[model samples]
Target: MSEPMSRRTLLGATAGTAVAAATGFVPAPATAAGNRVPAVVRELDAKIEEAMAAYMVPGVAYGLRYRGRDYVRGFGVTSLDDPQPVDADTVFRVASTTKPFTGTAVMRLVERGRLDLDRTVRSYLPGFRTADPAASARVTVRQALNHSAGWLGDYFLDTGNDDGALARYVDEMSRVPQLNPPGKYFAYNNAAISVAGRLIEVVTGVTYERAVRELLTGPLGLRHSAFSLEELPGVRWAVPHVPNEAQTEIVPQPAAWAMPRAINPAGGLISSARDQLRWARFHLGDGRVPGSDRRLLSRRSMHLMQSNPGPGGTLFVELDGVGVTWLLRPTAEGPKVVQHGGDWAGQHSGFLMVPARDFALTVLTNSDTGPTLLDDLFVGDWALSRFAGVHNLPAVPRALPAGELAAYQGVYTGEQIYFDGSTLTTQFEVVPDAGQLSVRIDGTEVARLAFYRRDYVVFPNPDGTVGNQRANFVRDRDGEVTWFRLGGRLYRRGAEATVQRRSSAPATLPRPILS
Candidate 1:
């Protein structure tokens, strides 16, 4: 049997007064009270410490930009082995949060008449083909950017540290099975973003990293942002952390230090909370580089990046639609929120903004368990609602009858393509447990699913309470359950015995994320 599924597959905030009373975390007094920390920020600090304790996260860096006021701060140590206090400049891998940067780069190129969003993928990279040739040809640049490519998105291939890494990665995408036709559905496809990166490389005649530096980060003055480990030596950087085998402590990952070079365009970014706030500011602004009149993209282009909704919906109420690498969460009669997030092996980062309100919030944590903290602060409680008056109210789950729940029980399969081109198959077995659906991987229970609205279900936390993240069951034209969509990847249903034989050995599962 192969190794069991690792935890990278599975991927809190408060007010001060009531928070301190509950968690026993006293907020530090602001210097002299002339600049007393905002009550919401103090509450956030208390909540951060509380969440850090609860999730065993070693360190975190958070920031907020609301109505022209700015706040950025860090907490805990960067690394336990050789500890250093984290500060605003301490860098953490922003992971898939890098998607917006890629999207911005494409927007810049489009404005310059170098690339077209409506063009077919093969028009830019002639070799771009998936398991379905027609679907591959039909896929547009916009479809890839908005993640409607209908192919495998959880692909991870370490295509070396050379300049040709992205090109090599896209060449192997030919083997990925297309789950839906082009523009038919939206699954968070990382491989599609890598294809977009290869397209950037082909258009600019430079590596994806170089193109981004020239197009976005360099122009935006994100001094502390970079895609390379070499640049890390001169600055303070947070080491990635994961839970111990007992799940009691957060420790630095042993060998999973950096992601494969090929996936850099998808989720390989190291940035500070301060820099991330600056990025959020640019997106919220009028398309000019901060402190300069030079325009990287016109205001119209920037708005299109955030406003143009894709045809396929992301299956969440808060997330109204996907736009060029950005998730749009439109609040009725309130601000329109544009956001994105990243999840690496042991780091979690999120960026959220409400352009009309001139508000943005960023959270970066140095542990694989960071999502719980994000759940409380950005998505659930204080930061988003306090700063922008935006809330992502979740659906209330209801008890389902055993017969209705049994329809979801089955063996489903997903795959991960490694650097050397070997594929790791992951099996998800859903069976009825106490009138609810229990999700298992290789007989190990990972989480339970309780129905909420329609085909959507909410994942109950370890304490038997529901969280904000939701997954859904997809049915075919004939009303037969055909797939399970979680964390933006499609797990196709298969014959029980056939799936069991193929999944005899467990493999890495896709980390469920909110991006």
Candidate 2:
């Protein structure tokens, strides 16, 4: 184990900051014949400092690459006690960023003709089942890959580290009812991925660990990275500083390895900035690794993993192209940018790709609250845009016109809507929508909602809509609709549902809260 570091020694190491406007990307031996560009590294350094103070961050280690050159920096302590400074090579638990690796491994099987994307899970695992036994056998590999499997978020509370925890969890999931048909809605989930991981092991004829080693790192020469937390000889490590709100006494959990029992493929990988650079570049090459004709996956398959399938097509964060892999968001500089963020026990990280510029930005941290690093990254990116003379694009700005509010009104219900009004007490019930109700509380239009069209169309403002937007409604013993739903959060469905109308009327209200 590495000795814990102190804040004094950590801050003392970087001791001085460069006041220069910008610095060249740190030149590396590997770039002898590669393309490289100068970066505003000095500005990046100052911006990170500002974000740390802003996000109440404990410590951060980040890498930024523009053109082909790389720049790495760290701030605060890797460990609060005897604080240790973070550096480019310092390892941090990358959490969900590991998903792409799993995605890649699965795609490799596709290339080998070992697995069929549209085939049913029972075709391979044969153990698949659902609360609705008839529908359970119908889940396809694609549904599992995209998280369209109507499985409720993992029964995380009963989850614990043990030999057969995963098996037990899968059994529990087999009997749970679906919120809707597969491919019917999007619920960013984790349990399904762990099941996918085990499925990969069963099909690949190799342990999950060894399969990734041969498929990725070994071929790509990623020396300092691995799915496990075991440190390389002579390599120093940084553990995660987790936030624990449950304790009577506040405590920060230090993690050398992610909780691997239930969330492995979903969230469990430890890596360093140096090694991560290779991972980002792999995707940058259009998912090609070095020289082998992109072995294990066709270019078509690679793009499929990152491209949204248009309208009615599935898009859950867990379903890559949406989550932490990379989704293109248009920018003023003539191209759509792709990016993703990852969070673990005590760490946060983000990866953004600009194919037009062939650029990638990566940041990693050793503290749970490292989420603050994003503010700095965006600020630095904005400053970069200004320096390059490119204007930044304005946000999409959701919702109908202030005046057209009436046109966009009337209770609209769908399996996926994020409407959580003010009150914090609520739950999902049979009301307007049979499965999930997407009640948009647009008071600008006399508090009404309309039938939602697709996933995430509920871009209603943060009057409360920020994170998970679960709706709440009430259901009678016969499973009949009563009112709209938003759990732990309440919203009165206009006047009719608020005041019962012979008990046969629709009730839908918008709010954001867990149900």
Candidate 3:
């Protein structure tokens, strides 16, 4: 009879020497080591190649840090037109991944007694207000960081790139509606995070970019990171790309110059793979500044930043919960995985770390399809399982009863969400077809929906590369479907006749041109 697999044997089989050395599971190898370095390199290369072929992403820069050693690699050309190959130093726009950096800066201020996470936004800015005055007055710094502030988070107005940008953005929030009361639900709120950035500036008496540089980049020696393309002068960077109308070929996109400077605190940091790894190490380390013993944030504050304060709806389902600007998911064996993903005009990036195993991974790509490469390629899963002994099973969709599916077919109308503009009225029409459903935005079919669980539906893009984005249908007291929530905004179901009559009308918002 064969004995059951021991814990050590299982970990060794899954994670090899990376986790072993970090956890002191066994003696470290003196030369070449017990680590399957060659195998890992080969596996990563193969997966990147496969993903590039499938998703048609123009370029990818990836870095991995395990047990204090770093492994970095680049794949494909910077652009289909330029044909310049990517390298370790190639910078890419890191979109919402910038949130964690902003959050870290706030924690530093908290340590210095310059800011209070529990304090209301009105306390510091005094100009901050929402359509719902009471909720705006009650929303706290912590709520904004964790995305629990119930205001309509999709408000993305560009208030200009002047020194008063964030302040002006806050002043304009009076027109934005409240999705729910403060701290009542978790909706990813970029506008609220931008407010947090404004708070940082208020306390530090410096520009948001300068505060970020002095507090984070300078301390960590992140030489290749900056807030915008103009800041990284003469540096070789990846050009963004998007598919042509036929979806058969990619076209080069201009630099993301239109990205409002006001949102830089939320999703505007551009960085290279090398510096991003360093940033991840700073978080995974003992809350101390790199190359110095001085503490930047207390160990307790770091733990607090990674702790789940309340329920997170869809993210909670997949990742277990969300912390302050971090996504917290636990492996079956009980160790937690902390990570964040970023997306913008024509770029996608991801940063992930396993604190228990002292392992981290970062990937940056320049293409509208880049997100598909990160999620569908199992980049995070491969790193966690091969280096941290964490096995994350792929999520599968469940089939709903025909009757249940029929009830969800309707036309819903709501504000069109934008990253930087006043909200525009938009329409969503759900139509059942052959057991599955199709979602049309502004009369164009954008995604196909499948049942993930009760009341939740996952919309997979028409292209097979991108993974599913989720939506939840909310019912009233009498069990009638009243509203549907997706991308952190609530959409009320419209009367069938009314929606049908209005669906033919031209959309108020212009379709986003990748350029």
Candidate 4:
């Protein structure tokens, strides 16, 4: 393990700032008096700066619309190696947030009577088959959209940059094992969505990117969005950055700039904050193109995309169910929110909207640790309450008896797959504590897992903030604790110690890597 880094080192590594002028997208009469930026937004700017310093994030571009006004700003340098101020037009990879675009394209086809949501996958792709042929035949387009296909979802096979990328990727799903019967449970399945993209390609007779452009992006006027690096020339884009091995200073990601082409439909769109806000605005408004009356989706279809189709639950407590492609959650003040976020190797992006209130927010950052900062600001009462008049209450941690906590003590093992088709063996050790369960990953204790309710656990951040992702312990048929579901992935609770003991060399403690 690398040595620890000092506070000064972390701050110095990320202290570079480049503030640009704020631009509003909403238009009023030229003679109308302009309103000053909200005081909350000014305060949010300082919060972003301080949090960026604390989390070692190099750059951020955010756009927000609330109460019929718009606020857009960028902060910090684009990259440490080559510094450039990020502006409203600066592009950042929005990753899995691209899922919604794919969803929108599928909806467009449905609106045109070209596709059916309830149709089985075999109806569209006759050759589509998973390891469980019986289950494969039952998977529907809606199941894939809602992530209930139940097959192993993290398959990220690189099929090269070609029109057949998604087709090749879906063919490989034949070997993926089904985790549950179709529509039984919810797992965050990237592989399932890739199949949905392939369906779009089959129905539209075009590449996934081209079809999305024709159905959504082109019609929506998102000129700053692109799916590949070659399309980014002459345009400013944020460089991905990550913490060094020492977890001290921020550095650029040493790997490839983007994911495999096959995963493009899952998460491959590079977009600017301005474009993201525009995208959210379209979702918040009626189903028409911004300035034109061209209706991409009917009102019923638009609302259907945001409505829950079946029983589904997410790892995050804030989210209750899944829409067509969006995560559905309710706020404390009685407003429902449809939102999605994305995570690339070193970049993080978020988009959220409360359709009832016409409030939308988009945040793009070029740092792996950006989510820590975003969880504090986005879900915290500051942004949601000040602008949307609603807030999400995180699960409150509660103390439990030692006997109750002891039942969960054990080492659980799992595998995490990345967009490059790489896998990492993961181990989690849960030990008994006075009031909570001491949760350790590998050998390092990272969180104090306490029950918020019955089997639901909440791990608050080190800074005493809530809104951190919550997880749960699963029970087997015999009523014995058997699985640990964290971040929507399952970890079985045995055989890990045997594998470690069988190794020839001494076990070295590696950093805990989570999806």
Candidate whose lDDT is highest = 1
How does candidate 1 fare on TM-score?
A: 0.88
Please give, for residues 93-145, the per-residue lDDT of candidate 4 as tens digits: 89889999989999999988888999998999999999899999999999999
Lowest-sum lDDT 10-residue window in model 4: 1-10
TM-score of 3: 0.82
Q: Each prediction's TM-score against the native?
A: 0.88, 0.66, 0.82, 0.88
Clashes of 3: 3
Error of 4 at 442 (Å): 4.2
In model 1, the worst 10-residue window by lDDT is 11-20
Write one digit per residue (lDDT tens) for candidate 1, span 106-212: 99999888889999989988877999998899999999998888887778877788998888888977888888988876788888888999889999999899999
Error of 3 at 374 (Å): 1.3
The ten-residue window of minimal lDDT in model 2 covers 1-10
Candidate 3 per-residue lDDT over residues 2-57, each given as its tens digit: 10100001011121122112222221111123455666656766676666656566
lDDT of 3 at 40: 67
* lDDT string, candidate 2, 177-229, tens digits: 45545654434445556667666777877656667788777787777676565
TM-score of 2: 0.66
Model 2 residue runs over 4 Å out of place are 1-39, 154-168, 231-234, 242-252, 255-258, 286-288, 291-296, 308-334, 375-515
lDDT on C-alpha atoms for all candidate structures: 0.76, 0.49, 0.70, 0.73
**Over 4 Å off, model 1:** 1-34, 245-247, 311-318, 330-334, 432-435, 441-445, 462-464, 495-515
**Model 3's lDDT to the true fold?**
0.70
Q: How accurate is candidate 4 locally (lDDT)?
A: 0.73
The reply for model 4, stretches above 4 Å from the true place, is: 1-34, 417-423, 463-467, 476-482, 495-498, 501-515
